[model samples]
Target chain A: MNADPTRLLAREMAARLRTGETTARALAEAHLDAAERQNHALNAWLVIDRDGALRQADAADAVLAGARRDGPGALAALHPLLGIPVGLKDLISVEGGQCTAGSRILEGYRAPYDAHIVERLRDVGAVFLGKTNMDEFAMGSSNEYSAFGPVSNPWDLDTVPGGSSGGSAAAVAAHHVPLSLGTDTGGSIRQPASLCGIVGMKPTYGRVSRYGIVAFASSLDQIGPFARDARDAAALLHAVAGRDARDSTSAPVPVEDELLHLPESDDEAVAWLRGRRFGLPREYFVAGMDPDVERRIHESVAFLVDAGATVEDVSLPHTDYGLATYYIVAPAEASANLARYDGVRYGLSRRLEGGDFIADYLATRGEGFGAEVKRRVMLGTYALSAGYYDAFYVKAQKVRTLIKRDFDEVFASGIDALVAPTSASVAFRFGARMTDPVSMYLSDACTLPVNMAGLPGVSIPCGLSEGMPVGLQLIGPAWSELMLFRAARAFEGLTAAATWRNLEPAQLAEADDAAGPTPAERAAALAAAR
Target chain B: MAGLSRSDVEHVAHLARLGMTTAELDRLEGQLNHILEQYMKLAELDTDAIPPTAQTIELENILRDDVATPSLPASAVLGNAPAREGDFVIVPPILGGDAG
Candidate 1:
C-alpha cells in the first residue's frame, strides 16, 4: 500500500502496522530513504544505522506475523512504540553502540550497557535510527558547541537549531524520523523544539529514569521526547516512563494513560480547557523578548482564553534569577560529573614527556574538551572552590529554592499550569548569540524556571515568528505530566488536528525549492517569468 | 559582580585539572568574567533567610539492600580504556607534578 508522507506519525504508523495495512519493513524503508536524502544537508543526525535499522525492521515484521498467526494472545504483545524508528541523543548509551555525548573526550568510548530508557524501548520492539548530535555535555543553548559540528536548522540552513537537543528536534521536524529522544537540563529539549517547530517535553525531574544517560547536572537532567505532535510524544513517553532501581532518583509514581484519556472532539477539548486556570508569568514577558515572539505568545494565550480557559497575570518573583542560578548550578555539577575523564580511564588521553599522572589528567581533559565545555568546567570549579562556595554555589541553591516556591505558591492557589514563551526568539543565524555568553544564556530565560522547580513543561509550535517557528510553553507542578499533556493535546487538537503537518517548519515553505523544484514546475515558473 | 582576571582563570583552570594554552586562557578570561558578571545578579537578592535546596525533590540517602548482584565483567568495564595492561589501567608516573 502507498503511504502518505505527511501521515507518518508514530501513533498512526503503529496502528497501521497492527492492522496489517503496512509492514514494519515498509515503514522503515520510507524513513530510511528520507533520512538518507535529507541527513547530509541538515546535519541533524550524527550517524545513520541503516543496516541495523532494517534488521530491526525485519525482526518487527516477524513479530507482527507471529501475532497474526497466534490470534489475540500475540496481539497482546504489541506496544505503542513497536515498529517506530526513534533517534537517540548522543548522550544516551545504547549498549556497545558509540555514545559520544558530543564531546571529543567521549568520542572513543562505546557504551557497555543500555540506559534504563533504552532498555525499556528495546523491550517493546522500537527500532533505533542511530544517534543524533547535541551540545557538548549538554552545556550550550545552541548546537554550535558540539565538537562534532553544529546542526543547522532545517528552516534556514544558515541558522542554528536551538541546543543541546537541537539534532533530535531537527530530525523530527525535517521528517527524517517520526520521533527522537532528548535530554533536558535547563530548557535544552523544549527550547530546541520551539526553534524547530515541533513538540518536545521534559517531565518533572524524577518522572523519567536517568540511569545510563551521561551525567551533566545530576539534579537537573531529565530525558524526554521530540515529535511532530503531542500525541506521539505522549506515546513515546508511555513507552519509556517508569521507575527503575538503577536510577536511585526515579520516582515511584505510576505512569498514567494521558494519550488514551485525551478528548476525542474539538468541543470536548474546549470543554477540557474550560475549568483549568493558567498563569501568564509577568517576568517571562520581559524587555528581552523579540517583538514577534511576544506577539505570538500572546496570541497563544488568547487562543486558550477563547477556548474557555482563564489566563491571569501572575508573578514568579525569582524568574529573573533562574538564568544566573542555572549557570552556577549546572556548571558546578558538570565539573563534578566530568571528573572521571582522566587519561587512566576511558576516552581520549594525551601524554607529555615531563607530565606525571596529574599532568596527564590535565592534558587529557584540556585536549578532549571543547572551549565551551572548558568554560563551564572552570566556572563550576570556581563556584564550588574553597573560598567561593558560600557566595556562589550556596546562593544559587537558595535562589533555586525561591524559584520552586514561586511555582508551588501559584499551583497551591489552584492554577493548573503556567503558560509562557519557550524562548526569547526564533531560530537565529549562526554566530548570533555566540559573541557574548550572557546573551546566549538569555535564550533559556522563559523555560529554565521549570527545571528550577522540577516541573514538567511541553513546547508545541504556536505559529511562525519572523519566518521561523515559535513555541507556546505549558508548565505544571511535580508529577503533573498528565495535566500538561492534556492541555497540550487540547491546544493541539484545536489548532493542528486538521492542518498541522502543512503548518510545521521543516517541509513547509522553501522545502520544495530546497528539494529542488519538480522539473515541470521549474520549467513552468521559468516560462511564466519569461 | 567583578570580572575574573587572567590569574583568576588560571587558578580555576588549574583546580579543574584542565591544562590550557596561553591563547585559550586569554580568551576564557574574558568570557568567564562576562558570565560571572551576569551571575552577579543573584547577589542582589536576599537569600539569607532561606534554606538552600541542593535538589528540588526531597530525596536523600537512598539505601539499597546489601546483596551481591551480577556485575559487568572486567573486560567490559575496561573495554573503552585508552591504555590498559592485563586488565589494569596504565598511567604515567605519579610524583613531581601539580596535584589537581
Candidate 2:
C-alpha cells in the first residue's frame, strides 16, 4: 500500500492485491489520476470511463475480499488481473462504450455488444480504464490519421508512437495503464510498441476472435497486447485467445501457458536459447534505415549469439512485393468490410440536399471518411472494379502465396524463428512520413510480410538507439507463440545487463526531458501548428 | 498513362458511393495513381501456375447446428443508428427522384 501501483507491473500490482495490501479501487483510482494528468499532452486516451472503471474495480475488490476469507491460496486463485486497469484500442468494441476506430465515419457511435476479448477481460477481472486513440479505421502508420488526434510517444513528444495502435502503446509507455489491447493488421500493434519502447505481440491470425473488432483487412488483422514485459504480454494473450462461436475464424486450439515455461534464472534462460536456431533475412537489414536502429538490432542478435544461438542468413525473397501486395489486398477487403457504413445503418451520415439514395450514400461516405481512409478505400475499390480484378487483387494474392512460401522454406530449413528489426527507424518527427503515401506504406516494411504469411511475430524492446528504443522482431511459423515467447523472454533477460529493467518510458520521460520538452514532448508544441 | 482522369475518378467515386468534390477528386486521382504505380511490381513475379490465396488457412464452410441462439435485441442494435423510427433506420426518401 505504501508504493504507487503505477510503478508496478500488472502482475506485481495483483500480487499486492492478493495480500490485501491495496484494493482494486485504489489502484484504479491511481491509474485514472495518471491518465488525467498525461492524456492532455500525450493524446493517448480517447475516452476515460472513471465511473465505469471504478464500478468494475469495486466489484473486483468485493471478489478479493470474499476470497480473502478463505486464505492467501484462495486469493491467488483470483490472479493479478483482478482490477488491473487495461486500455482498449478504440477499434475494439466495449459494449455501450464509444468504438470509433478513429474515423469520423463512426463518430458518435457506440458498440452494441462486447467484443469476444471484452467478454474475456470481464471474466478475468481486468478493469477497462478507457479507449485509446488510433489511426482512423486502422489505415495509417503515423497515428496522425486519427479523427480524434495523434498519440505522442512518451519517449519524445514530437515523434509519433507509430500506428494504428499508437494510443494503446503510448498509454502503456506513459504508465497510464500497465496493459492495453491493440489490433494489428499491418504492424499496427508491434510497430507502435517498437517506437514507444514496450512489448507487443500479434497472435497468429485467427488466434484471437475478431467478432466485435471493426474489420479493416479481415485476412491480416489480429488483436494483441502491449505490456512492459514478455510475461504480461503472454498473460494478456492467454486471457483473450480462445474459440468463440461468434468468430468462425477463431482458432480451436488451446491457449498454451507460454509464461509458465520461462526460466527463473539468467543461466537457464541462456541455455534455453542455445538449442534454437535463428534466421536473419538480408532484405530486412537493407540500406536507408537508421544506422542506430540497425546497430541496436544487431547488438541484440549478438546477445543471442552469446546465449549460444546459431545465427544464419535467410531470404524471404518476396519481401519487396509485400508492401505493394498488402496495399492491394488490404484495401480490397477494407472496401468490402466498410460497405455497411452507409449512413442508413449507423455512424456519421451527411445527408445531401437531395432525396436520391445515391446522393445520400455519396455525401455520407465522402464527408465522413478522412483523407487516408478515402485514399485506401478508393485504391481498394479500383483494384476490385471490373477489368482490374485479375491484374490487381488476384495478382496480389498470387504474390501472397509466394510470400508465405518464403517463410515455409525457412522454417523447413530448421530455423526455429526469424529475428530482425521490428521497424526501419525509431519514431520519426510528426509529418516525417505523412507527406508521401508510398513513404507511409514503407513504414510497415519490416512487419507486414509476416502478416502476408499469416505468421506470429513479436516485437520486444532490445535497447536504446540514440535514446529512442529499438525493437527486435521474432517471428515463428504458424502456431509458434510458445517458442516465440520463450526466445523473446531470453532476449528480454539479456537487456538487464544494459540497465533495461529501468527503461519504462513513463518513468524515464521525466528525467529524459531536458531543453524545452524532450524530443518526445515536441508533439504538444506541434499541435498548435496543425 | 496510369494516372486517372477527372471523369475516371468521378466514375469510380460513383461506383464506391463516395461524393468527392473537384478538389478531392483531383488530389485523389494523383495519389491513387501513385499508389497503383507501386503495385506494378507484382507483374515481375511469374504466377502462371500458382493459384491466388483467397484465405490464409485452408477453410471449409463452417457448419453449426441450424438452431437459433439468443441474438442482440433490436434496441441494442438500433441504439447507434443516427436517425431511427421504430426498429428500422430512417433514410432519405429514395424514389423522390430529384435533387432539391
Candidate 3:
C-alpha cells in the first residue's frame, strides 16, 4: 500500500480514475495504507476496513470500465465521489459498525440502520473507511473530552487539532484520507479544521440530513464535511446533500451538483464576489486575539481585496453574547436529547437489586459519563429546571434570536458573506488550556456565531502564525453555500502557492520530546486515556 | 460565585451520574461555579416581550413524512453490542451480574 495522494483534490482524484490515469482499487489501497500509517500517530481512525474498502474499490473499477466502454450513462451513473474513500465521525450511526460517539457508555453499541447521509454516500459509491473520534457526545470544544483520547494536530504533534471534529480534521490534514464527514453543533467542524489547517464546511442548518446522527442538540447539529480544500468540501456537500424522509429536518430542496464543476471564467467568478458584499463584523476582533493571528487575518482581507471582493466594517452587536447563549441553549437541549441514555432502554444498564428503580438510574448514569460531559449536563438541567427556566434558559433563547437577527441585519445590508479569524490563535499545545474550560470555550469565540445564527460557514487555510496554520472563516446566510464557496475559492486561488509550505510533520521519533510522547505512543496513550 | 460547597458538587455529580473522588469533586465544584457565574450576566438584559427562540432559524414543522424506510437487518444493528440477551440489549449489572 502506498501513502495517500497528497494535495490532490477529491474531484481531481476521481476524474483521474475515470480517465484511466489510475485505478480506483489502487487509490483506495493507497488511502487505506496511509490511514493505517497515520492512524497510529494521529489517533484519527476508530476502525480500518482493509477487506471492505478493496471490495468497493474493485466494484468501482468494474463500473467505471463498463461506463468507459459504453460511453457515459451506459453503466449506472453515480456521483463523482463514487467509490472514493471517506471517514465518518463516530457520533453518527452507520448500519453495521460501532457508533461510539467517543464514549465508553456506547463502547460496543451499533446502529440498526444507516444514517440518512450514510445511505446517500452509499448511493453515490463513497466507501466508508472508518469512524473518526469526537468530543464525547459532541459536548466539548476540545476533542480532549472524548473517551477515545485527544486527536493530535498532524501539522505539529504537540498542538491540538480542534474539536469535536478534531479527528476528522487531523485525518484529512495528515493526508490519511482526502475527505471525511463531521458534524457542527457549534464550531465542531470549522474550529478543528482551522486548527489543523484544512477546509471544513458546515452547511446551512438543514442542508444536510441528521436522521441517524445521535442527538446532542438536535436543533443545532448539522452534518458537514472536512476535506483537503474547499472544492472537495463542496463536492462532499453535493454528494451527500438534500432532503431525506429519514431526516425530517433535511431541507426540502432539489440537490445541486453545480458546485462540483464551477466555471473557471474569472468574470463570472469575480462577479459573484464583487457584486456581493463581504461583511467584517466588528465584534469578532476579540480582545485576546494573538497579534500574529490578527496580522494573518488582515492579510486574508488583503488577499480577498486582491480577488475583487470588497469588505466593509459591519456590526453584529449581539456577537459578544454568542458563547453564553450557546452554552445555555445547547445544554438545555442536550439534557432533553440525552435523556434517552438512561439505564433502562439502552447503554450500560446497572441493576440495583435492593434499591428502587430511581436508585438504579442514578447509579447507572453516575458511572457512564466523563467530568466535562457531566458538568454540562448538570448546568443544562439546572437551566431548564423549574423556577430557573425563565431566567437562564428562556433568556438565553431570546438572546439567540437577537443573535440571529444580527446576522439578518448584516445580510440585509447587502453583504454576500462575512470573514474573520477562525480562532483567537493558532493551535495550542496539549494541556496548555485543557484544565481551563472557559479558555477552551473561548477558542471557539469567532466560529460559534455562525452556528448560533444557523448559517453556512467554511474555514480555509489563510496564512501562518508563529509557524502554525491560521484560517479565515467565511460565513454566508442560510443556504448560501455556493456563494461562500466562490468567495473562498477566489481567495484560495491567490494564496494557494504560499502558506502551508512549511507545515512538514516531524516524524514521531524526531519530534521535540517536550511535546509529549512519540506520535505512536501518543496515539496509544489517547486510546488508553479514553 | 466561584466557590461551590461540597454538597452542591455532590448534588450536581448525582444529577450528572458521575462518581468523583474528594479531590476531583473539590476541583470541579470550584470550576463549575466559576463557569456558571459567567452565564449569570444574561440576567441583566430585559427580554420581556421577546419570544424565546429555540432554533436560530424559524423553520417550523420541518419534519419528514412518517414513512417506513429501508433498514439493515437486526443482526447488523446488534453486531457490536458489548452484551445482549436474545433480541434485547444487555448491560452490566448495577448490583450483581445475575440481575440481567
Per-candidate TM-scores read 0.94, 0.95, 0.91
Q: Is the docking of candidate 3 incorrect, acceptable, medium or high quality?
A: acceptable
lDDT at A471 for candidate 2?
Answer: 91
What's the CA RMSD for each of the models? 4.9, 2.7, 4.0
Candidate 3 ranges with C-alpha deviation above 4 Å: A1-7, A72-78, A264-271, A353-355, A499-530, B1-4, B16-19, B62-100
Interface RMSD of 2: 1.6
Clashes of 2: 6
CA shift of B33, model 3, Å: 0.8
Question: lDDT tens digits, residues A425-508, model 2?
Answer: 999888777768999999999999999888899999988877888899999998888788888888877766777557656433
Candidate 3 lDDT score at position A253: 67
Q: A1-530, model 3: which lDDT tens digit per residue?
A: 22245446687678777778777787788878777766655777777777878887888888788788997665435577976888899987876678888887777676777888888888777877788988899877668788877777876775778898888888887776789999998899999988888889999988898888988987789989898777788889988888776576777766666788665554555555554568888898999889899998888887677667788999999888888888888888887777777766556666776645556666666667777777778778877766778778889989888888999999988888898888988888766667778888888889877888889999998877766788889999888898788887777666656746435543433322344464445645544664
Output the better candidate (1/3) by TM-score.
1
Per-model TM-score of chain A alone?
0.94, 0.96, 0.93
Tens-digit per-residue lDDT, A433-459, candidate 1: 877888888889888888878889999
Backbone clashes in model 1, listed as residue pairs: none
Q: Enumerate the chain B TM-scores of all models.
A: 0.84, 0.82, 0.74
- Alpha-carbon error at A427 in model 1, in Å? 0.5
**Backbone clash numbers for all candidates listed:** 0, 6, 7
TM-score of 3: 0.91
